[model samples]
Target: MADAPQEIEALIDMMARLPGLGPRSARRAVLHLIARRGQLLAPLAQAMQAVAETARECLNCGNIATADICPICASEARANGELCVVEDVADLWAMERAGVFRGRYHVLGGTLSALDSIGPEELRIPRLLDRIEAENITEVILALNATVDGQTTAHYIADALEGRVRVSSLAQGVPVGGELDYLDDGTITAALRARKTL
Candidate 1:
C-alpha cells in the first residue's frame, strides 16, 4: 500500500471495511471502479452523495426513507386496519419481498433489551400506540424475530394493546416445504406447541 497511489489506497481501505469485503476484494474492486470511472464510479459517487443527503427514517414507522413519511405510510391502499410490527426495517422489507401481507408495517428499530438499556421509548412503542387509534387499526400482528428479546417485546406490546386490538403472531413452523428433521429443537417444540387441527 505504501507504493500505491494515496487516493486509491484510501478508497480500498474504506471499501474493505464494508460487510463481506476484505482487503483483497477491496483492492480488486477499487481497480475495477477506477477502470470504469467514467461509466460507473462517477455515477456511483453521485448516487451515494445524494442518498447521504436525503435518506432519513420515517417519523411514524422508523423505516428508512428520503422524506419524513415513507411511501408505505403515505399510500391510501396500505391502510387496511392491519399493522405488522417488526424488529427492524430489514424484516419489513423481507415481508414485502414475500408479497403476501397487504397491510402497513411498523419497524421497532430493535427489540427491548435490558442489557443495552433499550426501552419502549427507544423503540417507537409510543408512536405505535398513537398509530393504532389514528389509523383505526383493528389488528396488530407481532412479526418480530423468534429470538428471546423479540418474544419479550411481543409480549410487552400485547399487554399494552390489550382490550384495544386483536393481537397475533406468525405461526410457528418448519418453513414452507421444510422437513422437521432439518429444524432445531426449539423450532420443533414451538411447532408442536402451536399445532392446529386439519
Candidate 2:
C-alpha cells in the first residue's frame, strides 16, 4: 500500500473500513474495480454519489428514503393497525424482504444499552409512543434482535405501552443473539406467524 499511488491507496483504506472488508479484501476489490472501471467501478461510483446526495431517513419510520416519508409510510394500504418495531433500518428491510408483514414499521435506530449510555431518548421510543395513537395502532410487534439489549429494549417498550396497545415478540424461529438481517425469509415468516405476547 505504501508503494501504491496515493489516490488508489486512499480508496483502498476507505473500502477497508467498510463492514466485512479487511485490508487484503479491500486491496483485491480495488484491483478488480480498476480492471473493470467502465463496467463496474464507474457505475458503482455514480450510484454511490446519487445515494449520498438523495438518501434521507424517513421522518415517520426512520427508514431510508429520498423524501420526508418512505413509500411504505405513504401507502394507505400498509396501514393495517399493526406496527413492527425493529432496531434499525436494516432490520426493517429484512422484514420487508420476507414479504410476510402487511402493516407498517417503526425503526428504533438501536436498542437500549447501559454500557453505551443508550436509553429510550436515544432511540425512537417517544416517537413510537406518539405513533401508536396517531396511527390507531392495535398491535406492536417487537422484531428486535435476540441479544440481551434487544430483549431489554423490548421489555421497556412493552412496559411503556402496557395499556395503550397489544405488544408481542417474534417466536422461537430466531436464534439467540441472531440479528434480523441474517435470518432467512422462511424463518422470518414463521417467526411473524408465531409471535407471542410480551
> Can you tell me which runs of candidate 1 are displaced by over 4 Å?
none
lDDT of 1 by residue, 8-95 (tens): 8999999999999999999999889999999999999999999999999999888999999999999999999999999998999999
Worst 10 residues of 1 by lDDT: 172-181
Alpha-carbon TM-score of each model against the true structure = 0.93, 0.87
Kindly list the per-residue Cα lDDT of model 2 for residues 110-186, writing each as its tens digit. Answer: 99999999999999999999999999999999999977899899999999999989999987577779899999887
Query: Per-prediction count of colliding residue pairs?
Result: 0, 0
Instruction: For candidate 2, report its TM-score.
Output: 0.87
Off by over 4 Å in 2: 173-198
